[model samples]
Target: MVRLFILLAAVQLVLFVLALISCLSAARVRNAPRLVWVLVILLIPLLGPLAYFLWGRPLPAPEEGTVPRRRRAPSAPDDDPDFLRSVDTEQSRREREALAQWEKELENGEPDKPQGSA
Candidate 1:
């Protein structure tokens, strides 16, 4: 019976320390504030630590659940509106002309050969 009591006490002490460290280190917590959580862990024995574990722990940051920015956003120049907007109009017109010429070459079924070199 003495051994059992000693084991329980040890468990309670471990719980109290874990709860206190978690409460202090967390960037934010839910329900009660940090001081209240600290007090609860220190004063309420086993139940205090259990309550802090259940209610005072912070929710996962919202960004953690979603795809990262690189995966979620467009990676290609032609597909991204912002990239197109930042391009100079003259440069954009030149690109369009180059694309049109390439398409015309494809339609003609001619083997692509370097011009001005042949």
Candidate 2:
């Protein structure tokens, strides 16, 4: 009975210290302010620190070298194969459109006079 009480008290003390350290070192606390967490840990004892451990602390950030893989954005269009292919298709389409427009203009009898000439 007394031993169990002592063990419980020691556990609570360890949890309190851990919660305080986590709150102080955290970049951002979730759900509540740091002051509130500090107050709760100091004032309410066991339950307060337990609550902080459960929900207030942020998850550990990924390490510098062990971060999850992601597809990087191409720095230039030339670096992207899809963009290179699309550029070819787009240039051809523009050329075809311009030829069709010129043919239509010829059929309509619009003289292709040089611009800026009287």
Considering summed lDDT, which 10 consecutive residues are worst modelled in model 2?
Answer: 60-69
TM-score to true structure, per model: 0.52, 0.52
Residues 2-95 of candidate 2: C-alpha lDDT, one tens digit per residue: 9999999999989999999999998999999999999988899799999998989897777888966578979988999999999999999999
Instruction: Give model 2's TM-score versus the native structure.
Output: 0.52
Off by over 4 Å in 2: 64-118
- Number of the top candidate by lDDT? 2
- Provide the overall lDDT of each model, using Cα atoms, as 2-decimal numbers: 0.88, 0.91
RMSD of candidate 2 to true structure, Å: 12.3
Model 1: per-residue Cα lDDT over 65-112, one tens digit each: 686454456777888887777786768899999999999989999768
Pairs that collide in candidate 1 are none
